[model samples]
Target: MDTSALNEALAFKSYDKIADICDNLMLQVASEGVAFQDEWPYAVHLLGHIYINDINSARFLWKKIPVAVKEGQPELQAVWEIGQRVWMKDYGGVHEAIREFSWSAQTQGIVAAFSELYTKRMFELLVSAYSTISIQDTAVFLGMTEEDAANYAVQRGWTVDSESQTMTVRKHKVATEQKLDPSKLQRLTEYVFQLEH
Candidate 1:
């Protein structure tokens, strides 16, 4: 399959198409796994996870659209709808109604305006976590220091655990459930919630 097709599908910005494409890709991945007779590898799952997370992040960014921007750019609503369709397709039997993070609708509702802002806030928390990077083999990916990074996350309503040095992101509905599905898509969804506090 053409990998570029995925890119094109994502760029479409129609929620239905996005969800459909996501579902198609996911089905392909599953079929490939079955053909190889191997459990789905971590890398494959990671790819799906990244796809979902990035879109969610985009959704989050969509929220910052100013009132003037909305009025001036009514076409944005169509773009967002397309994106939702493309990104939110049900993964197997994971979702009941719309193809969104399991708790997304319940947590934030389905209204585009509300979801846009919610997604943006979630993205902020996520970006804050990568303020700095450390390479495994003495390599380095310098960025904002851990302190500053943590502070950045904290500003977005996350509770930075200085003791454990581990950040715990809270979701909208379920506060006790810290972990999400092991699949990459699930991980991305959970990660955003983790960053959001």
Candidate 2:
């Protein structure tokens, strides 16, 4: 099957199309026991950049590159370097690589993927830093309406306020059984409360 379609989809910024192709590629590679052969490395590289989104998984795939190929192709090494930086949450390094890495027309999607990944990491950091975030802050960060921000946060288990100014994590009540051991239950309750924060 022609998995190169993923490359084209990525170049055009049709990233949503990449997942199925990568899945199919994985199945095909698994069924055939294809290791480091016939564009498998490139496909894995694409998965690393565009789909896997984890340092260890991508690094695992990267190690499968044939020694000869790893040494012979400069672009492969370059791609690996760029992908590792992205996986490491080094957005500034990625931005510098975008300008400095010799990107051919065929590889333009790597830039887009890196940019999206960096933005996603930034958003994750921004959200994680706050227990209670205002709708205005959410709207500004996401470029959406306050209502949309509240809706989004609510869907993700955050509680929208009466004034709709902030979204806090929804706290669940601990239902303790009176019959259970009191000491163990108190410790469990304390652990649960600690996790909420």
Candidate 3:
């Protein structure tokens, strides 16, 4: 997919727009028997990120948070609900629906495997971010070899302090006032995923 296609797919402000794009992408992957390795998961994560990070959009989508809390549901449940809504809106609902819109056995298997791998990998990355994990520990957690972990860190431009047994993700000081472009980052992510694809 081209950058414009990605941008168009992600720029969807309506559920129908996103649903169409996602359903198409899923169908393409299924027909080709190609796994949804990189861009696929990144696209899903990007949508989740946008929902949580975009003030206006997220404000609208997350309105149920307080309602869920008032009803005495767990906060995580609320978050999960939001996530589910985002997924359903963008991706033509869920697995059953996506599967029902299937292609062939090989294609279906590819899509299923890709979805599992993408979600698992994303969860591993998210969990590591919230925990004090060693490189080897995170490598195991992500089901990646140590070299793959190191390579990813390098790609992210994080400094590896081997002697200290830690890799420090360089933080930009607000005082310096630098910003990363969301679209650029998305492109980089897409490009990386395309390599695996």
Candidate 4:
């Protein structure tokens, strides 16, 4: 199978479209009755799922990969390590895995993208879930050094108590309650009445 398209997609950081591209290519390979020759595409496809925060899909893909391919390709194994960390909600492990692996040029962009997205997600979760959090925990969650995490919290308008080494999160303002649509409610009531009758 020609890999130019997959390479092109990676070059442009088109992560969202990678699964579709790989699926179509797999189909094409199957239709032609040829075995998969390259392992890089599989690695890219798996990382693409990770980039989109689709752990289940990434797990499914991992299961589908042949054992030999999984064993032979360290990059693929590294990608799966990140997926495992994500599945376990081991944020520190995720950062550690990303840092420890020597990612190839082709997969680097998607891995970096996933790292940034995951950190952003953790930041949002911390903001919503914590009134105040310790700098060490925030550093682990944000995949940053303690000093960098402290600075990041301050930059985001969070108040850091230097003596306590804790940062007060800036909570988002809760939106006012949305007005229910009368027509939808009336239809639902009529449906319930009809069902009861």
- Winner by TM-score: 4
lDDT of 1 by residue, 97-182 (tens): 22333322212222343234334543444445444222210011112346654565566555665565665543344357666557
- Per-residue lDDT tens digits for candidate 2, residues 35-128, read 6364553633554444446556557656866787777766666777767666766655555555566666655665556556655554565566
lDDT of 2 at 159: 81
Give the alpha-carbon lDDT of every model: 0.41, 0.62, 0.45, 0.88
TM-score of each: 0.21, 0.50, 0.28, 0.86
lDDT of 3 by residue, 92-151 (tens): 233233334433432233334434544354444534463333566445444456677656
By lDDT, the candidates rank as 4, 2, 3, 1
Lowest summed lDDT window (length 10), candidate 1: 134-143
Would you list the clashing residue pairs of candidate 3? none
Query: Candidate 1 or 3, higher TM-score?
Result: 3
If the candidates were sorted by their TM-score against the true structure, best first, what order would they fall in?
A: 4, 2, 3, 1
| Candidate 1 Cα deviation (angstroms), residue 143 | 11
How many Å off is the CA of 141 in candidate 3? Answer: 3.4
Q: What is the C-alpha lDDT profile of model 4 across 1-197, one tens digit per residue? A: 78688878888888887877887887888899997745447788888888888889889989889888998889989989999999999998899999999899888888888888888899999998999999999999999999989998889889999999999999988989989999999999999999999
